[model samples]
Target: MFKDRLRATRISKKYTAQQVADYLDTGLRNYQKYESGDARPTFEGLVSLADLLNVPTDFLLERDEYLDALGVSVDVSLECPPRRPKPRKSH
Candidate 1:
């Protein structure tokens, strides 16, 4: 599933396998292993690949279904507020 998506996206973006390998700073054989499903990328590498492919990491991992199930919306401008600690109650 992951390999198919990676290959399809790479081709759709008109990127040669060697180009991707170079971008990822990995050898051609090592990158080929990723396509062959004989190896998996590290979390950092996954993020880098997703960035280069202009996709979310979940899409590369075939985990986007989980996000769809939750119906979560991605908004770059949304910022999370800091949480305040609760005051201690008197004994």
Candidate 2:
């Protein structure tokens, strides 16, 4: 499910395997392995891919069932907290 969803989203977004590899700074062969399900992405890599695909990380992990089990609604519109400004150094 993870492999299929990842491939579908990538294709839907019109990204080639090489494009995804370049975007993630991963090797083409390694990225291909991910799509083939011969390899799984690390936690950080999964997050990066999800961000690039504009999908939830859980979606990539095929964890929607877990979300359903918890009765947690998925809302992608939740805004991230704004970055706090760096403190100015006193001269």
Give lDDT tens digits, candidate 1, residues 1-91. Answer: 7877777677666778899999999999899878768898999999988898877777777776786887743322212233235469999
Off by over 4 Å in 1: 70-91
Q: Which ten residues in a row have the lowest lDDT in candidate 1?
A: 74-83
Off by over 4 Å in 2: 66-91
Error of 2 at 29 (Å): 0.8
State the C-alpha lDDT per candidate.
0.75, 0.78
Q: Report how far residue 39 has shifted in candidate 1, in Å.
A: 0.7
- Candidate 2 per-residue lDDT over residues 1-91, each given as its tens digit: 6777778778767778899999889999899888777898988899999999887787777788887887765544322234345569999
What is the C-alpha local distance difference test score of candidate 1?
0.75
Model 2 TM-score relative to the real fold:
0.69
RMSD of each: 17.7, 15.1
Best by TM-score: 1
